[model samples]
Target: MTVKMIAVDMDGTFLNSQQDYDREKFSQLYQVMKQQGVRFVIASGNQYYQLKSFFPEIEGELSFVAENGAYVVSEGEEIFTGEIDPEIIQEVLTILAKFKQGHTILCGKNSAYVNEDEPDSFIEHGQKYYHRLKKVPNLFDVKDDTLFKFALSFPVEQVPEVLVQLHEALGDKVIPVSSGHGDIDLIIPGIHKAHGLMKLQELWGIKNHEVAAFGDSGNDLEMLKHAGYSYVMSNGQPRVKVAAKEIILSNDENGVLLKIEELLGN
Candidate 1:
């Protein structure tokens, strides 16, 4: 099967906690992929600003599945957008606040508002990698219209119950996805990784058998299961491995780059 498109996740699948990337290897593979007419779509739960921060130079070439499939962009143009209803967001926020007490993050297009600041690797990583990233102490101060994602982190074990509660509260209005941390993500209705990636395929006229994907979390499962040739990182979650068609080396091991090289050689 010929792979005409590749969709990859960011945090665990591409960037490590240190915010460092295998730039040289990735650049080389990107060049090869381009030469072969393969389109690269970045599929993640991150907001548009967050995704653009990583590869600012490719704003024109890259397509994105931002806010966990709530939005889709191809060639700097929007192909689809599924924003959560404002009322639903407010309701969900109230429910989350009740459970979280003081540890929730409400994200807009370009910023994140928090109930209380907590120490997390994501906070530090944002400081190091993002330009003009801001933090708000409360969601009450946040104005809507650009709201995209609501991410919250609590004690790891609390996640299962928290997710169930969110599903119960939001129902079909929003969907929950995980970033593979203790965090849970709330996105607009019908917006999942799989849906967004499939949209990308249709936009580019690429068939399911012509698509490949790489990811490392529970959030990545749907697409990993649906892609033509899905790959899970060696360090990825066990369930991700179960869903993937193949297993590659860890992100730190330049697994994606090596695989791309093999694909090009063949």
Candidate 2:
């Protein structure tokens, strides 16, 4: 493989069910990639802060395409950000207010905002993915921060229905992507994991063929098609698997790392 950049999705693609990866092995791989001038990009629907926090030691050496491509940070610098129109956000909030079930999150650059009226379970779950979380009286009353994506955690069955409703109501204003585990994110239209990768590709003058990507869900479809070389996790969504150039071991098997080793002849 003639790759200059490697991008990996977080949840089911790279991190095991324990919400973590093998640091020692990954650190070693990081060293080798750095030596070979391969840019390592962490692309996910997760918050930027949470994503970077996982790789504290090598964070400055890596790039993050977070919030499902609404935000991009490279080498410790903010490269780009996609913002949702305030009017559109208001429309979304109105729709969500009628949704009795699930928790709504206003993903912002400063922090992930939630309704303080939420139960303890919601707060705890929010904390897991958001490092800097704020509990406001109501998400509607908050408007100080620049927002990127809108997220909801509800029943898996509701995902498809809600997404269809959102599409019908909002049209191309916003898009929804599942982050697995009954979590869905509404991001700005035309922005996704692949958008972030393309930004990095342009900045580094690397072509699509020079980038290899790994992902495991519907949100990863665009990215899989964007990369010249793309791998879908063995446990990936059936739809996504159809688009990948190849299939790899599950996340628990350290497939990303193993694939890298094979590619680099380690």
Candidate 3:
């Protein structure tokens, strides 16, 4: 099958368990894909700044479906954005307050806001995914910023129940999706990785059938289905595997790069 654009998730689908990839091989592969007019898109739940750091060599050339599709950046420009209403953000924060546990981050276009009272370890962990993090006295007082999503981290065992409660409380106002490791992101309704991909398709005039997507978690379900060629990493969640059209090796094995090589007959 012919592929024009490729969208990949970061954590488990592209990066290995160590959160790193085969840079040498990927750098080479990127050059080849560029020459062939193939677009490489990083679709992740991470912030745009964090995603951009991974592709310094291909910065402007790469596309980003960041914040789980709440934001899209192409050619170094923000082409589309889906921000949550201020009132809705307040409601979500209120529900989170009831839990009184887990780390909460308010995702914004400029920076991510976190509670100043969080433990240093938790703040450091948040830094890993959110590059532009700011400690705030109160999340409710965060103003004059374009809020994208709310990301929370709870104990792994508490994830299921927390997700259910948030869904029931928030209803149609937000889309709560897990990005594995007990992390949940509250996205704007009707906006997700798939929606971001569709926006890119329109701008590039590329058809869905010409897209190849790789992902490994619940948040990636819609994206995998949207592509003509969908691959679930061997290490991906069980439900993600069921939704994908095919399966490939784990991230550490360079599954995504290998598949692309095979497709390009390299």
Better of 1 and 3 by lDDT: 3
Model 2 C-alpha lDDT per residue in residues 16-49, reported as the tens digit of each score: 9899999999889888998999899999998888
Order of quality (TM-score): 3, 2, 1
For each candidate in turn, the TM-score is 0.87, 0.97, 0.98
lDDT-better candidate, 1 vs 2: 2
- lDDT (CA) per prediction: 0.75, 0.89, 0.92
Query: Which candidate has the top score in TM-score?
Result: 3
The candidate scoring highest on lDDT is: 3
lDDT (Cα) of model 2 = 0.89
Q: Compared with the true structure, what per-residue lDDT tens digits does model 1 show for residues 1-266?
A: 58898888887887766655777777778888898999888888777667877777777788988767777888888887775567767787777667743256666655656544655655664443234355667566567446767776666777777778778877877677667667678776656888998888777788887888899987888888778989999989887799998999888877777776776674
Candidate 3 has what TM-score?
0.98
Give a tens-digit lDDT track for model 3, residues 1-266. Answer: 78999999999999998899999989888888989999999999999999999988778888999999988999899989887889988988887788876789999999999999999988999999999999999999999899989999999999889889888888888888999999999888779999999999999999999999999998999999999999999999998999999999999899999998887769
Using alpha carbons, what is the TM-score of model 1? 0.87
Which scores better on lDDT, 2 or 3? 3
The regions of model 2 sitting more than 4 angstroms off are none
